[model samples]
Target: MSNITNQSLSEILESINSKKISSLELTQAYIKNIENAKKLNAFVTTTFDQALENAKKFDNKPNNDQLLSGIPLAVKDLFCTENVKTTAGSNILNNFVPSYESTVTKNLWNNGAFLLGKLNCDEFAMGSSNETSFFGNVINPVGDHLVPGGSSGGSSSALAADLTPATIGTDTGGSIRQPASFTGTVGLKPTYGLCSRWGIVAFASSLDQAGPMTKTVNDCSIMLEAMSGFDEKDSTSINKKKESYSKNLKDNIKGLKIGIPKEYRVDNMPKEIDELWEKGKKILKDLGAQLIDISLPHTKYALPTYYIVAPAEASSNLARYDGVRYGYRSQKGKDLIEMYENTRSEGFGDEVKRRILIGTYVLSSGYYDAYYLKAQKVRQLIKKDFDDSFTKVDAILTPSTPSSAFKIGEKTNDPVSMYLNDIFTVPVNLAGLPALSLPAGLDKQGYPLGLQLIGKALDEQKILNIGYAFEKNCGYKNEIKKWWS
Candidate 1:
């Protein structure tokens, strides 16, 4: 058989439905690719045996009508997969296996999608660089030492390396978009509540959202449609009919008003990012999009406010793993209190602990009103900024990250610098809007740089349309040489 691993998700699906390729053959190809690309370390656990069994069952009676029947993809370690090890890239949950599946993954399986395995991520999805992952940082396929972005680093890296045709990732303050930006992949963070969060390991309940990270824009739309829906089990899940985003994609942006937020022009941005932004603007303008300069004035405060709010929720949600429940526990503690403290202290990485401390401190009585409350107020202003801009423009455009992928360990010592990677992406999550990162151009070092499209709440179709137009006209490509093989 030909190298099916190099084909796009849509192509693979078409071939499968035509009976030209079986899911079992495609699954085996990906498994072989995963085994050969171990140097990237994109996966936390590889479910090769289970994936083959599932593929064999599907091949027996293929359902061509289903949305994702016989398709294989990887799930980020954050989502709970029944009977599969679902570690949120932390040693605390190294042995954790969910008896129940997360709503997002369950929906995919119901549509006949097979899981390749669990992808790596930052410890509890807290960091911008994948270096914080307890499973070890996922290496960028573009460069030997370059970081693949975080906390969805593994998801992005795997897709870029062709180890998986598509993958799912969570966006908690740019975990999905930033990594997609670095890896030159397409990642969508759907409107908050569009996808159910139940059974997913919580990092920040309010900000965390499950979305697809794929090689192409159409794949993202198809994956999003399959993964999203209402779930009574999750209070935050929106009760509405799922959208057919894939069917709605079109390569036309005639007369669409695209907003260019002035506040996104951060200080000391690299020339390549600025150029890529300009290139994107030119592409949209050429396609008949009316580019309007808009101001999201409160954007400056988004990162600071997000730091306070996300950590606060994370601290609360993570308190469940205090050694009394499932997950890691300290064997050296003599007392209950000591065991709780020791277990967390040893289990969590430095970045996760840092956020937890910041979270706990802000929520404490002495600082609750001063820090956490004020941050909440600022968050509203951030949302209001988007709300005001969207009224005038159909979509907003900006650089996904300040720069392209940097070498691993370059910013591990400086947390602030690492946090800056998500400066352009955090506001969208804070405002609970849908955003996508698509490959736009390559930096001077040949690393891929991405541009983002921000849309109104629950209006993913518009952004996907805009992205599809850009992808067709932009001529940007994401292929990389197989250095890890």
Candidate 2:
């Protein structure tokens, strides 16, 4: 039964559908694994009893028509789960459980998937490493001292550790892809408007999008089908018909053109990452994908532009947590104004406060045009760079990160160095396009390295298929041992 946990989500669903295993058995197996892997600190809240009850209910009334029938999935805490503690990895929302469900989770449940629990994340999804999480850092299952990639670290850690078959995570910048790269898994950031953001806690609203992180490319397509749809409540939602990404998946990218951006070869990048990118090009070439050397001149401006825009949005979105409504409050305040100041001062973590200050400064009347407004213009250029490249290619290829996962405390003191971790990933978010990261190889330290495929907006199916083709031919394997359990 414990071995059942090692199977991919698709295989688990097949076992359930074939009647070889019941939902209860699968749920129980995951519970045991979660119980044993406490040191990973991946889960912020465990709904084991609730999960078990849901599993029983699912087993008795199974529906084969549902995409994820009886599948128990864990999601990043950024989502507002009804009656479950929905902390956005910050003390401010530590006790704020939504009475109503988020539109994305509601869709999953409606399609027959139930919650396993809420996983941890960066405070307000701001940090590059899970260290910013108020609950504490989530250890990467790949190595004991390594930091799982941030924002969605807990989601990646759990999925890689097999605590959940597959999980959903929010990506603002590189949250989903970077961690997926570090942990030897598949993570996708869909086109910005493709998934609704109504129920998720706001990070950088315009940049934040929900995506699936899974063990396989196939599982990613299946999980994504269940999680994405148009919602009236979300102003940014795209009103396109739902896509059967899994059913239509094929690796027939024989003549598809993939762009290899010259600007992505950043200074001081690890040789292994460079090698992995080269290997990715060769693999695609062997699969008959035409590799075109392209240039994205605005790539150099992406990181700085992202830093300005994301924080500007963060400052505005996080102003609601002033202790006046819900969430943490400071009882020591003598007046209303003092209370408001005290609550925020006490509620947010250092990284959250840092971003809030940066956001506030950039959006201030005196500097708005100098910083925030200019960044928006640069963002347009970044999008245009992608659009220009897409005119000649179907997708773009790059290394997912500059290097493999680093130690937990290695770059915490230097914010600039920490920010560089997202250099390869931030541009995709800035452009509002879809991108997928898959493990391509391992570094000298035996840590996994990844390659990214960038697709045009609403072109998720093409990248997923390209990734699926790469996954089958690339020989990359998850060599991570279950050391925590």
Candidate 3:
């Protein structure tokens, strides 16, 4: 592997600014890395020509004031990149290219970051594993046959494999953080509405939020600062001034109150996961941060509530992908209705179809009150639970996942088993909070284990500070061999 692949995002930017490496040279090195890493299936579409062109353009300008000047990164295919194909990992929009770019991607570009390509994800961002992608499952860089958790699997895989310095991912129920945990990378799911959703393909509008995946918490803070702002185009976009999160990442945690929710203690969890949780608590306690035992009494119902609410929103949002306007259309359909039916049946993967069906069923007339309505109420209660808890604590600490990354095909046959992977993560989304996953240590199999730091809405800087303190003391190194190379 080239030495360039080992550099952090900030290091790369510094190298570019100091004339140690030209933008074109660095971009070409990453393009070469992506070319050699095809076996990982991390990229759905490679934009080498455009990336090189942009690199050359930035090289000509040489602006030191730009935030991410000459930086090479990848965006998850869920984000529209103006003329680049945004697949969302489903055949339904296999050839769909947007005339406009998502606000998040545009923000990165405006700050002088150029794209390497579009990363793969779950079909309509539906699956916990990247297996639901029409392209293929993204293989974890740590182990040959292990799965990189999804629907942002490709983003996480690319970051871990060093194909890109950093990448963007969307987290709807652990899509970003889970994959980051699996791959031993850092990922953040910013508070809902912190980053605008305009032009990104929506899975569940209420739950989906864009965040950065990188090698360190500092990179996450910088990227989150760059990507977040108010956008009048997106109704849910928060109308708050952009925060200098990177500047505020102090590693001071003394006297900060951290909450440990008792409901997170699920049964049959791996002993290693429990041990890691205890280890994380000790690390925080030793730093003089108070750890209080708290109860999120409604946590047990989070998964079920998410299933109903997310699918209902997904069913509504995805209804526009019929054979009429754009995307993949069916040639076998005889008439309009049949065209709609056949188009969806042929284009959607089984997991996406399943969610759409469940969504539709829950939103149906008679069952609406019983399922979707009830789930919405439960969702509010979940949010309220966090609201009540946050009054007593500054942040919450939990395990990112129930266990380490499983093999690619380990739980494919059991949908419920797959759903349980996001058990610890779902509640954060339910409450529209900011949460981050950082490498804590290696598991017994030498794969990475993650510790999650969740904060109240828009309190990303606090959790990031805590994560930085933990990272400094944890001594967790995310070094992997050039297996893909």
Ten-residue region with minimum lDDT total, candidate 2? 266-275
- Please write out the lDDT profile of model 1 over residues 157-269, one tens digit for every residue: 99999999999999989999999999989999999999999988999999999999988889989899999999999999899987899998998889999999998888999
Residue 45's C-alpha lDDT in candidate 2? 98
Q: Write the per-residue lDDT of candidate 3 for residues 189-284, one digit (tens) a residue.
A: 999999999998999999999999999888898899889999999999999878898888899899999999998888998889889999999999
Q: TM-score of each candidate?
A: 0.99, 0.99, 0.99
Worst 10 residues of 1 by lDDT: 1-10
How well does candidate 1 score on lDDT at residue 39?
A: 96
Q: What C-alpha lDDT values do all the predictions have?
A: 0.92, 0.93, 0.92
Residue clash pairs of candidate 3: none
Q: By lDDT, who's the top model here? A: 2
